[model samples]
Target: MTSRFTELSVDCHDPERLAAFWCEVFDFKVIDRSEDSVEIGSWVPTVEEVRARQMPTTLVFVQVPEGKAVKNRLHLDVSPIDASTEDEVIRLLGLGATRTDVGQGPDRSWVVMADPEGNEFCVVRSLASQD
Candidate 1:
């Protein structure tokens, strides 16, 4: 079988702060934490579940000495489950996210935003609002 996309590791200056911000962004729970890292997802899975690839993808924030210096080559694209894109963007802003420009011009459907740690991501229109 092919490998599963299980976890995304992010290097940051403060794991706890980034973890907290992301958890609020996605309503994720902190499944695990260590001295230099924090893992957040929808739930805490057992080793068996993880090995079987039955767990949802999780984000792991690790402490690093260097700060983010350039635009992200890879980023996450998210849609709100129960809100309009504008509302979701407003909510994310309230949670400490700031709008960012990565050459995404005014006509694009997705809005670019940066997390507290300066990682760029997108908020796209929800399916519920499209029809």
Candidate 2:
């Protein structure tokens, strides 16, 4: 059998804040919440048993050490799910992502941006445009 990605958890100082930020970024919803964490998902899992047994698929933002350096070895590369690249960039910026310069020039392509926790991500041009 082949392995598949069930979730993408991010370590942050504030889980709720990060979760909220990602929720807006991906248009995901808070399907579950606790004192220390929240679970945001694109699909709505039915039944409590199903939700619990379904691998807890979510982008969990857990609390971490303070003064953590802004160096993420693994970051997400998000593309517009249903909107244009420009629109997606605007939405992400409004959701708290800041434009960052990772030495990539205009010729290199992709809009480089950082999350609230200083994690760098790229927003490339729409896939539809390539086709």
Which candidate achieves the best lDDT against the true structure?
1
Off by over 4 Å in 2: 1-3, 44-57, 128-131
lDDT of each: 0.92, 0.78
TM-score of each: 0.91, 0.77
Candidate 1 ranges with C-alpha deviation above 4 Å? 51-54, 129-131
TM-score of 1: 0.91
RMSD per candidate (Å) reads 1.7, 3.9
Kindly report which residue pairs in candidate 1 clash with one another.
none
lDDT score, candidate 2: 0.78
lDDT of 2 by residue, 31-93 (tens): 777777777888765655454555545687767777457567787888886778778889888
- In terms of lDDT, the poorest run of 10 residues in model 1 is 122-131
lDDT by residue for model 1 (1-131), tens: 65667899999999999999999999998999999999999977676777776568999999999999999999999999888999999999999999999998899999999999999999987855455
What's the CA error at residue 10 for candidate 1, in Å? 0.7
Lowest summed lDDT across 10 adjacent residues in model 2 is found at 48-57
The TM-score leader among the candidates is 1
